[model samples]
Target: MDYQSIKNILFKFEPETAHHIAATAFELASFMPPVLNALQKRYLVTSPLLEQDIFGKKFANPLGIAAGFDKNATMTKTLHALGFGYVEVGTVTPKPQTGNPLPRLFRYPRYEALQNAMGFNNDGAEIIKKRLERIYPADFPIGVNIGKNKTTPQAKALEDYRFLIENFKDLADYLVVNISSPNTPNLRDLQNEQFIKDLFIMAKDITSTPILLKIAPDMSPEQAVNLTATAVEAGADGIIATNTSIDYSLLKGAKDFGGISGKVIKDKSFAIFKEIAKELFGKTVLVSVGGIESAEEAYRRIKAGANLLQIYTAFIYGGPKLIADINKGLIEALQKDGYEHISQAVGADIR
Candidate 1:
């Protein structure tokens, strides 16, 4: 049956429960090579036109599954099979976290959005590191998105990130420093210039693995540009334009807590990303996330200076077909625009 039919049944359960059910399917598929290969054959879209090398890795396509969907490393193989160019796992912490109280994940199907207050819940770095050791060095790229523990004081947040970076640097093709998640108390406060400088400096000292900074979309274009510029100047290899947004009004009947993502935040995210891109596009690798739902949006991000693109909520709503559809649509769009390769379109608008 189709994903929408499946989603209709899945939607009957609470969002978190439905997510676990779906995640379990991917986890199980990892052990079955036949299932994986089959999924890849049907969903995976690869073309020389879409292929680009970033951070010394070959991304078969620019589209990737953003960090939160595969918070643990279990789904990497399956996600790749489902046509994601890369899979970013974890918002892992120094310690295992239960996250916020239950009922923390909610879905707004009409808006194609989700609000999650899940605060860095994961199996912790030690466990996740072991998981990656067994699974890393795959044909595709894998990124580990790390964050500070909830109980860790803001004063000690640097140490938490330092520990996570040290543990994951060798395991992941790249690493993402996730200080901008809105669920963690005082996490966004760490987005300051001095702290970003110190964090990237410490990361550079540890491993040469390309580390990128993930920021929130709640800031002004000016703040976004300044903060990202600071990150790149301080040795960050790339920047993921945004995490999720805390702007509740974007979706009517929104929760006062957690962060909102998907269709509702598209314009907000694109505006901030465009501003950041105008200033820092060529200075570092640029990744655009938040509310990317189609080929047109993906192309817009590329032209606006995104070297890579990621999707989470859209995947939930649009299902697996969306992945291949986007890659195919991107190819068509690029050819129609008189571009031979995806790289040629990167920052076309900015140039």
Candidate 2:
């Protein structure tokens, strides 16, 4: 059957456990060139309008699988084969850590969202680095998202970010210094002026790869503009508008304290992108991802000043059809607006 039929069965498993089953499927497929090739034939969406040129790299499309989805860098090929133009791997730390506890991933299908306190869980950067020794030749871009270890205090967070970036910089197309996940204690504090300057200055010194700051969606528009400017001035490459939002008024009694992602964070994410875009539109690339699961959301974010975009929640709720569906919708939206190139429409509404 199709992905939806399979997902119906898989939904019975715990969210995290189900995620591994899915990841393992990709892991095995990564080794089978034929299966991967077949998947590409089945799901890949190609259109000149969807191509994006940024960071001196040309992406096949702007839609990417966000970092938390592939914490181990294991699914770049499968994601590419399934038509994602890029994949961000990890919130990997210097050392492997068992993030939070079991059942860390919770599904809110009613809201088409997920709550996770997976606290930077991964097999550590060293192991992930070895896994990619052969998986980096896919047709799309691969971005590595680095995070600090839980035991490491904020004062020493720089070492965690530096070590991982230093190790994986050359192996991937770009890198994200993720200080936004609410699950990580005091991690958001890293977004403050002094820490951002210090961590990024040290990070930029370590590699020439494009470096970005993934901020939380809970911050105000003013905070976003200030932080985006700070990162750019510190010699950073771009901004990933948001990670996961902490707002839960609608789900007030959901009993999960993890950061929220998917449909709930869309407006927050888009508004932040618009605010930052006001000043940094041409100065730095804006990677937007939050509650985006439709073509309208993607097109609107681009018009509001996003150069690239990503998704995780919608991918799960909508299944494998999500990417191609969104891409098709984006093309229709771009043409309807009388735009010849998607790039020409990047920030069409940001005046």
Candidate 3:
């Protein structure tokens, strides 16, 4: 296999199955050092120009495969081999979860997007923590995204989050508090100022893991500003702007209910990035994701104030080559603007 052939074969299977097969195949390939090296030489772009320092950690490149792709941390090494500078694994809950019923993941090839109500499905934080411990690497930065189980109520959400933090604090490179996924009932409601402050306080006391809050794109500008302020005041290390959008007005006749991601959310993602940039003013790191299918869009987001950029839908549409291409485009974009590094370009477009 070639990329498209493998993609076609995977596409023939159901969406969730294809995801599993791909992840497992990559995990198998990761053991072959020669193969992994060849992939890195071909796909992973390492240039001093692309290096970035955020949240007290240095990234070899600013591109990361956003959370949800590898929910179990089984293929982090392989994904890194495929050119992602970093890999974020799991929306791992405190306990194992079956997630929403079948047909949970739907693909809209026409829109170059996917709508999934996976409901934080994973093998649990303990399992993921053990797997991560077995593959520990000094240089690899693996961020773990933590979520509450479906049975966990809104009232006790903090306890669920703290449980994972306490268990995986030493195992993960950083921690992401994912409260924006549309699949979980009332999950996004935690974005409220009071709730967010309370959650952060709990997270703060448990460990020193850099904590970031992930927010949805459907929020109003006022909501975005308020959330950003709340996170900053609560001592959040960073923010992952504009998670998958629930505003399917664009997909009105196409699909019913689920989070929408891809080109449809590009402008919205950028607008939220800009709003957070203006309000935070480089006080906290911003990881932008949504609608970035090409280098031009990635460059635009970095210029808009994202210290780091992540992709999921684009990886599905563009294949593995997209990663190297975006890094190449980013280097060019930086040169065009007379900047010496990626950090110099952050927030260049915003006044």
* Predicted model with the maximum lDDT: 1
Cα lDDT for residue 154, candidate 1: 91
Candidate 2: where is the Cα deviation over 4 Å?
Answer: none
RMSD of each: 0.7, 1.2, 1.4
* lDDT value, residue 306 of candidate 2: 86
Per-residue accuracy of model 2 over 158-262 as CA lDDT, tens digit each: 887878888988888889989999988888888888888987789878889999988888888888889879999998899998888778764544554788888
Q: What is the C-alpha lDDT of each candidate?
A: 0.93, 0.85, 0.85
Q: Candidate 2: minimum summed lDDT over ten consecutive residues — where?
A: 248-257
Instruction: Please provide, for model 3 over 81-126, each residue's C-alpha lDDT reduced to its tens digit, 9 standing for 90 to 100.
Output: 8889888989899999988888888888887878877888899877
lDDT of 3 at 306: 87
Instruction: Put down candidate 1 lDDT per residue, 208-320, tens digits, no spaces.
Output: 99999999999999999999999999999999978899989899999899999999999999999999999997889999999999999999999999999999999999988
